[model samples]
Target chain A: MSDVFLGITNGVLYGLIALSLVIVWRSTSILNFAQGAMAMFAAYLGMTMSSHGLNFWACFAIALAAGFALGGLTERVLVRPLYKRPEINSIVVMVGFLGLLESAAAAIWSTAPRTLESPFSQIYFEHHSTTISLSPFALFQIISALVIMTAVGAIFRYTNLGLQLRAAALAPEVARLLGVRVNRLLTFGWMLSSAAGVVAAVVISSSGSIGLSPTIMDGFFVYGFIAAAIGGLESPVGAVVAGLLIGLVQQFLQDYAPSGISSFAPVIILVVALMIRPQGLFSTTKARRV
Target chain B: MISIANLSVSFGAVHALTNVSFDAAKGKITAILGANGAGKTTLLRTITGLEEAASGEISLEGTSLLNMRTEDIARAGVGHVPEGRGVIAEFTVLENLRLGSLAAKVNFQDGLAEQFELFPVLGERRSQHAATLSGGERQMLAMARALIAKPSVLLLDEPSLGLAPLVTAEMMATISQLCEKQSLTVLLVEQNAKSALKVAHDAVVLHLGNVVAAASAQEVASDERLRQYYLGLVDQ
Candidate 1:
């Protein structure tokens, strides 16, 4: 029973990371392999600020803004050149970015993982006989994920800017004809998704000691990618739901199955989910040509 | 006024347009009639700055359009309704209209009420996404989008393609009225010879990327031999 709760919580975190993946994929049709690294980088920035005894809220704000800036800059600089290239080329560029950012963080911040403590650990919830202390990290992770989902959904449904952003993704030539200022929109997309990644990183980093160490983020990247693929790469709601399911699966597997095998549940589910619904859980049957 | 000289585009071995040359005078509808793959669409694309011409000079209103960007070309009074209408599907008809208005320097938001009179169907569907629009409605929205841009020259490629005869005729009438009302210079590319000729003031016939004939619309329409021989259609 505890395992179920644990898995569900972890899955929510994974869902946030998955959300980042889906956001990038939907906008540019490029799977950003570096999204995890982007998250870790922002977390590293927060760690630096936090180590100086900065307040949690301030660190969070700084780290998140940095996320947006880094993402926007990356889109405008490193990734913009490959925009006209094929999807494979963009994917390769993302891989390169992953390597470069990870290595850069290591060179500057060292291979050591940093301790990122949360302020909300004081809160507690008793479930039956077991007591679940709602750690600051978990509270932030769940709330932040929900917030990201709502904000993104609202923008999509209610705002002209959101509609324009989506139109550029679904039909770029048409968007251009409408004079959408395509370049600005691309930067905006990167910033929005990258900011989401930063929020995920901040929440996740608080759970464990993570350093400027790139490998500290490697596991979450794997899990996030798996969650995203399982949920369907294109749908935001699909990714979140898939993330929660993955979380539940992981917890149950860890509790019941051998500890070693449980670690690989996400991968197994990833393969099965992809095989069953290649388009995604949420994607409709209608094939979109553009 | 629009002029293209020495316009050519090639996809490796196959040449799409080989130094295609033509002129569409101000306040006139110049129709280009050619079979599929005859570089008709390519010509329109070249004009719209979608394709880079191998070497050419495109001048409009005494200004060189050479090496101009597509958006800039659009801003500079050239409106292109590409083969598929190029309507942003996720945007509502009103949003789509506003977007087109945003393309030009002159804001058309104030003219929305008046413009609705021109495309009442779009007015009725002001809040619906363009994706849900029917084939004819989609074509009308596309045309309305360009018209709202208030362009000096309207470049339409295969506007009547994939539309029913009645719908096509309605589109033709809308375009004719637009040309008359706006005194708009239009470059229309169509394989449908009869209707294209009916609406055009001048016609440029192309066969395999070369201009086979260029004359007044009345002269070309009256030439039964030319219609049957060059255009591949008999007048009703």
Candidate 2:
């Protein structure tokens, strides 16, 4: 029961990161390998703000804004010039960007890990003289993830901007022919994606067990990517569900199985998912007409 | 009106279009007929700013269209339905229509109503993905997408490429009706010279990237040597 609660909490965090990845991937068709590093940078921004005596909410807002600016600048400066180039060029560039962001963070803040204080109490809630595994901070994480996911989903589904974003992604030439400013939308997509990543990073760093470091998000990114793949890279709903499933699996394995074996959950599940459903579990198969 | 003067395009050593020139008069259908590599598609693409002109003037009314971005050209009221209809297969009919309306900044409800009246099949399948639409229906949707913006000029590339003979005739009829009703300056590229000439007010025939003939559609259609050599319309 405790494992279930823990899994749900961790799953939502992973889902947030996966959601960020999905937003950028769907809009631009580029898997940003630098997403984790960007999130780390944003988390550091929040930590720095908190150090300066800013409130938790203010720091969170500033981190998201910073993420938005960083994402837009990256798209304009780095990605735009390589749009007509080969796919491998963008992939290699993102990988290079990941390294650059990590090094920049390390140079500015040092390589040492720093603890992030959670706004809510991390102590377990007591019920009938027995302490449950759930904490106020954990509850906050779950609610925040759900709210953000719902809002993002609504934005993509309901708004005119969302319709244009999907069109720009699916058929840019067609979108441009219709007068959509696809280049601007691509930059905006990156902004939304990075903001989502900042949310994931801040929440995860606020966990008692985790600390803010340049490399801390590396493991989360791997898990988030696996969730994105399993859920179908094109489906946001799939990403959250898959993230939760992965969290549950990891929690169960950690509690019951041999300690070392739990670390291999992502790899084993990813291989199994690929073998079973390479197109993703949630993706609808359609014969695309060119 | 859309005007093209001394338009030239090149890819490395291959000249796709060289000194091609024509004017598609307002409220008229100007059929650009040629063989597969006759640069018909390239002309439309260049006019829409998809391909940069090496040296030429392309203008909508009196404004130069060269050196402008594709989206800017679109916003400037040059609607192009490129080869393959250029519809997003993943989107539903309504969603595709809504995307088209975004550029015009028109009220979506009004645009949707107008397009539905024009292409009734799209209204019927408004919720179905465009991938499921038949070839003829997809062509109509593409036309509606361009029309939703209410552009002054429309550039259509091979709208009748894959339709049946009956469907092709119907599509051509619709294009003719649209040009007359909306006073649209239409530059239509087609491989089907016979059908294109039937509805076109004027014709510009291209052979190997050069305009071989520019005359009334009737004169071009009636010419024996031009039909035999360029149009592939060997007499029965």
Candidate 3:
């Protein structure tokens, strides 16, 4: 039961990152291998601000703004010219960007792991003289993830701006013929994606057990990508659901399975999910060309 | 009115269009007829700024369109329905119509009502995804999407492709009616010469990237050499 609660909390963090990846993928048809690194860099910026005597929320706000700026700049400077080029060109560039961000972070912050305490209490709540595994920080993570997901879903589903974004993503040339400004929308999509990534990174680093380092988000990114694939890269709701499922599965395996089996959980689940449903567990349509 | 003068386009060593010149008057249908590789599609694409012309002039109501972006050209009131319908298959009919209304200055509700009145079937299937619509419905939806913007000029490329003859005739009738009622400047590109000549007031025949004949629709239809060679309208 405690494991279930813990898994749900951690699962929301994974879902948040997966949502970010889906945003970028749906808009640009490019898998941002640098997404984790971007989040890490933003969190490092927040940590530095915290060290300078700023409050946690203030630092978080500044970090999110930095992430948004970085994302827009990246799209304009690096990804814009690669549009209509071969798919591999963008992929290679993103992989190169991942290395660049990591190296830059290490050079500036040094190799030592740093800690940033959550604003909320990390200690579990007690009920009837028994400690429940769910902490205030964990609850905050779940709530924040839900809020971000709802906001993003509303933007894509209800608004005129959302319609144009979806149209630009689905048929850019057609959208342009109808007078949609596709280039601007692409940049906006990247900004939103990176902001979501910042949320995930900050939440994960705030967990008491984890230490923040330049590559701290790399493992979470792997799991989030698997969650995105399981959810069908096109659907934000799917990503959240799959992220929760992965969290539950990993928790159960760690508690019940033999020694080293938990480490292979993500890969095993990914293979099984792909084998069962190649289009995606949540996807209604057939696999897209991209 | 839309005009193209001395327009030429090239891909590497191959010339897609060469000195192609024509004028499509307002309130009339001008059919650009040819067989495969006749530059019919290229000419329309260049006007909409999807394809660049090497050296030429394309103007819409006296405003130069040669250097504008595709979206800018659309905002300038040139609505182009490209080959393959270009409807977003994932979007619902209403959503597709709403996307078109983005560029329109008229009241959105009124524009939507007008579209529904013009194409009644679209209203019936407003909630359905475009992918589920039949060949005829998709074509109508594509045209209605362009019309919702109230574009002064409409460029249609291969609207009859893969459609049955009856549906093609019906589409042509609708287009002719729209042009008459709205006084739209229309450039209709088609490989189906027989059907195009039915609605066209003027016609231009292209063969090997050059205009072979330019005259009234009746004259082009009557010319035996153009009918047999350029349009493939006669049995050789």
How far is each candidate from the true structure, as Cα RMSD in Å? 3.6, 1.8, 1.5
Off by over 4 Å in 3: none
Clashes of each: 5, 0, 0
Model 1 ranges with Cα > 4 A deviation:
A1-8, A49-55, A122-130, A208-212, A256-262, A267-276, A285-290, B5-15, B18-22, B88-134, B148-152, B224-229, B234-236
lDDT of 3 by residue, B76-124 (tens): 9989999999999989999999999896665778988999999999999
* lDDT score at residue B140, model 1, on the 0-100 scale: 82
Please give, for residues B1-236, the per-residue lDDT of candidate 2 as tens digits: 88889999998899999998888898999999999999999888888878888998988888999988999999999899999998888889988888888878888899889889888999999999998999999999999989998988999999999999999999999999998899998888999999999999999999889999999999999999889999989888
Q: Per-residue lDDT tens digits of candidate 2, residues A162-235?
A: 88887888788888888889999999999999999899888877877887788888888989998988888878
User: Compared with the true structure, what per-residue lDDT tens digits does model 1 show for residues B1-236?
Assistant: 89988887888888888877778988889999877878899888888777888887889987888787777788888888989888877568887777677757466676576578988988989989888999888888888887787888999989998999998898888888888888899999998988999999999888778787789988988888778887887745
Overall local distance difference test of candidate 1 = 0.79
lDDT of 3 at A172: 94
Residue-level lDDT tens digits of model 3 in A1-290 = 89999889878888988999988987887889999999889888887898889888988898899889989999999999999999899999999999999999999998777777778998999999999999888889899999998898788888888888889888999999999989999999999999999998888767778867888888889889999988888788999999898888888888999977866797788889878988778876677554
TM-score of each: 0.85, 0.97, 0.97
- Among residues 3 or more apart in sequence or in different chains, the pairs in candidate 2 whose N, CA or C atoms overlap within 3 Å are none
Residue B33, model 1: Cα distance from true site in angstroms:
1.9
Q: Is candidate 1 or candidate 3 better by DockQ?
A: 3
Model 2 score (lDDT): 0.89
